[model samples]
Target: MEQAFAQNLMQAAQAVEQQVDDELNRLEKLTESDIEKMRNQRLETMKQEHKKRQEWLANEKLTESDIEKMRNQRLETMKQEHKKRQEWLANGHGEYEDLPSEKELFDITKKSERIVCHFYRESTMRCKIVDKHLEALARKHIEAKFVKLSVDRAPFITERLNIKTLPTIALLIDNIVKDKIIGFTDLGNHDDFSTDVLEWRLGVGGVIDYKGDLSSPPDNNERKKKITVFGKKPKTIRNGMGGDDDDDDNDAED
Candidate 1:
């Protein structure tokens, strides 16, 4: 009877140990779940804080006085820079050394058969527009070359071209004058003049109004007609020699 009682006690101990292990596993799982929840809550709180900070920054206002002060500061900075540049240029500083010379400009103009030279004054709207269009025009017509000469930068070219306008566009073929247009109007009008200049240079006669693809070769007949130089034709040898001298002599002998 005492042995059987000891056996029962061993069974009870085993059952207690199993219950303890099960409870420990459940507690650990609960602890991990709580930690995960806390981490997510912390992340959400940080996101909310960031959003609030961005909103506050967006709502922040700058008064007229603040804006005026900022503008004044910028203007002062610009003035100082302008003064420094002027001083550097006046003192023959090497910073402004690589500017294009008159001789270089002349050489470039002479080398190009179909050359488009632009003369423009400094800080002008027409000048800016011309500057922008020059490269595009050059690319569109590879046969033509585009060059920019500033009235302020190259005074000699400006004087030589006799540029009285703010933006002067000169088209030359073989160093000979083809056509010239001055000033920049509205986009519509400016495009008209640009088209006119290009068409004339390409020997397209009058302005080509059609906006079809320019990559295709122009009409052969139209090209011939436009390029043909109008002048008196040379007299034929037969006409000049009075209808073949040998035939005339044989007829006279007969």
Candidate 2:
């Protein structure tokens, strides 16, 4: 009986040791799995942060390129403006050798002779076209003097004339502005432009007579005729009535 009891106690001790060994193995597996899960989570977070940084760098590069492009464009525009200014200054500061001054312009009008003034922003294609017409008119009317002025060089004259558009023409007689026409026109349209200039000369009444053989003789009967008989007055005639009597009255008043 003593031996049997001792054997049973030994068997109980072996069973308890086996149970403790199994529990320790299960705990080791759980701890390894948890550690692996934590490592995977940390790696994923690092990848996400790296991706975000790369995207931010790409956006910053794009923004910098856009800013550089705008700066280049503005610099190019400034260069063009400077070139234009230099050209204007090189051309005698906007005054021609025989060109009349503001006071001289007024004197030309007072003399009853018509003064043709051409205002240009620059020597552009449109200005060249207008200049050709002016040369033709100078040949056609010896009594009229053709004057050229550049707006870029003569800001005071441009401002005094209230010239807002490029390639403007003004007809002055006896220092009074009789008519002004604006814009460029085809050579085919020169007849209309010439007509405006002629009308301004006629506003002087008796100061300068048309000397061209092509000019018709002035008839007192024609002078009594209505303006409708001679087609419509040009839209450029802002002031003045179209009659020799009106001119006489104005002269008398002066």
Candidate 3:
């Protein structure tokens, strides 16, 4: 009986030691799994932090090219505005004026980019007609200063210009005479001419493109009709006379 009891006690002790060993193994496994999960979470957080920083940098950064393009665009805008202001100030800095003094005429030429001056006589009907056209043009082309000085009032300028004609329209650029709108023929007869005739004459000054249609009499249409000039095809824009190439040597000969 003593020997049987001693064997049973030894078996019980062995079983207890095995149970403790199994528990220790389970605890080791759990600790390892927990440590792996923590490491993975830390790695994921690092990746997320890196991605967020990259996005912030992209949104906030401006490249050299971007800065240069913005600067150029603003500079161009400022240049255009400055050019326009200079022109406006050159044009009496206001609306068209019947220049009160001859000095004002000289000042206008000195200041403006373009000059369209009408040498008018109060009693002359043709001068009156030209005045109306000039007034309308002044409002349209602000880049050019339009002046109306009475020939009787501004005798020195009239004599200097040698403007003997009753109504003379002069277009000057950079203080030099470019073209003179000569007779009443290009403009209709007597006081009947319209603003369009003046616009047509000023086309050479780069103000407008004359479409060869004048506000003249209905009979003038015959001059503008589809004509074969120089035995060639007609074009889109025309000489003031006709839509065809009127100035072509062959057409002029015809």
The lDDT of each candidate is 0.51, 0.53, 0.63
Q: TM-score of predicted model 3?
A: 0.52
Residue lDDT tens for model 2, 1-254: 99999999999999999999998887677777787988999999999999999999977777777988989999999999787655534432223223544454444444334566777745456666667656665554445556676666666665655666656666666555565555532112343345434433333332234543222212323444343213233233333212111111111000
Using lDDT as the measure, name the better of candidate 2 and candidate 3: 3
Better of 2 and 3 by TM-score: 3
Task: Rate residue 51 of model 1 by lDDT.
Answer: 100
Model 1 sits at a Cα RMSD from the real structure of 25.5
Q: Pick the candidate with the highest TM-score.
A: 3
Clashes of 3: 0
What are the per-residue Cα lDDT tens digits for candidate 1 across 1-254? 99999999999999999999998997677777787998999999999999999988765776788879989999999999788655534433321112255465556545444556666655777666666655555545444556666667776655544456666665555554344444542222343345433443233211112244333213222443323322211111222101211121111000
Error of 3 at 36 (Å): 82
lDDT of 2: 0.53
Candidate 3, residue 86: the lDDT equals: 76
**Which window of ten consecutive residues has the lowest lDDT sum in model 2?**
245-254
